[model samples]
Target: GLGDHPTVLYLGKLSRLEGSELLKGIIEEVLESVPNAMFLIVGDGPARESVERFVEQQGLSERVVFTGWVPHSRVADYIIAADICLLPRRHTSFSPYTSPENILKAGEYMALGKPVVAPKMGGFADAEFPVIPAEPEEMAQAVVEFLRNPRQVPEFQRPTWEVSHARLQRVYSAIGAVSR
Candidate 1:
């Protein structure tokens, strides 16, 4: 993906449909451009074996670490260890439903003041984070740019549990008013 960067992370389920296939190309392109770069492929799925094989085939085993899956509480540790947070998901038919506000990782990565490189689809074009096409070339360019000139996160707004609960209460009240 053209986003989210150094000590780069391609976080999500390790499935081809999730854009794991894109990583092989992106990784090759990125390594050629930024030889010192390392990648972290976090999460587990059916495609894990093949993805690892491809990385090894490219002789990138030393540079890419596959954590399989980590506990949710530990996710932040990985994000903190990285220079950027790249989501490996391609824009899908359901993409219109995805946005930094709804995607927990986008918020997590941003909360840590890291650039989030996500696809240009969905509502991300106007997003405060780096929005670009996930094609390998485009993504690599955005990623390299961030690594060369790390973008600073200005503000990340994710409703806390208390805030979400209050919103739900308001929603329920509205429903009850309509019934009455």
Candidate 2:
């Protein structure tokens, strides 16, 4: 049961590259303001142990729920269960120059009309939707504020597979024309 407590959902791999350390810090900060808030991490990877250790060290085992890894089919259920979605990726060597080519996760959250708090890095910086800073203090503040006063879900225009395929075809045709 989701109950009445606000839930913060992070649906991605638990790896160093995914910024697990930064996530721990953000959770700590969020607990300061909203101790009852629950964190739902729904993925697993090499960094899972480290994140789990941090939770144990901080005595946050009760607040943080590690779902390990769920199947793609069940992902929507978790997303729907969350009040806020978090994407706390830290800046890495290639982050400044590169953005995530795959916006599927973010898009899914937006499609569900959920508020997503992500770091302003890489592709996230260019995201059409609003994103919060990567800093723990700032991210935590954003989460706390949202829990206190829920905001209106933005109108999202998620592209379907057919729409994306058509767009790609157009781009390829344009490139072919230019090459000729």
Candidate 3:
């Protein structure tokens, strides 16, 4: 994950299967092209210790900041503080489907007016957010583009949660009344 500046931030637990290495590779490439960027990782899990060790071994300790386990209520603070929200969900043979809930929430971040840069896999590909291919290199490039010019991202149009609930009320009324 990158930092407050133009950097690649990974906001998830560190795990080999979660594609941390792939993200790291992408960040390295991005740094090569744009030397000012950095990486930021939020959250902690079973893989945290190993990932921190790897960061130290690879001399990326300065580039990465591990926030450990953040509470759900406080999670949004991290998201809101970030220039971009990242969700690099990796799929396996056993993993049958990708849910868009994360993408939707990321969209919420965009609705709050923050540009998102995530892989176009699972539900991410279908989200309203401007998602690109799942390649690490491309992901880095995408981040670069977004940070450079966030206005190009898809505009946020979804109503707030309250508005959505009100719309649902209308749906219920129509369903119960039957189409005239």
- The numbered model that scores best in TM-score is 2
lDDT of 2: 0.76
Report the lDDT tens digits of candidate 3 across residue range 1-180.
233456555676666666666666665556566656666677776677876786677776776678887777876676666666666655667443444555565666656556566556665666554444454447767767666665534332445677677777888788886343
Task: Please identify which of the two predictions, 1 or 2, would achieve the higher TM-score against the true structure.
Answer: 2
Q: What's model 3's lDDT at 91?
A: 60
Can you list the residue pairs that collide in candidate 1?
A: 2-139, 3-117, 4-117
Models 1 onward score TM values of 0.74, 0.78, 0.70
TM-score of 1: 0.74
Local accuracy by lDDT, each model: 0.70, 0.76, 0.62
Please write out the lDDT profile of model 2 over residues 44-100, one tens digit for every residue: 999999999999999999988999988999999998899888877666675643235
lDDT of 3: 0.62
**Candidate 2 local lDDT, residue 114:** 76
- The predicted structure with the larger lDDT, 1 or 3, is 1
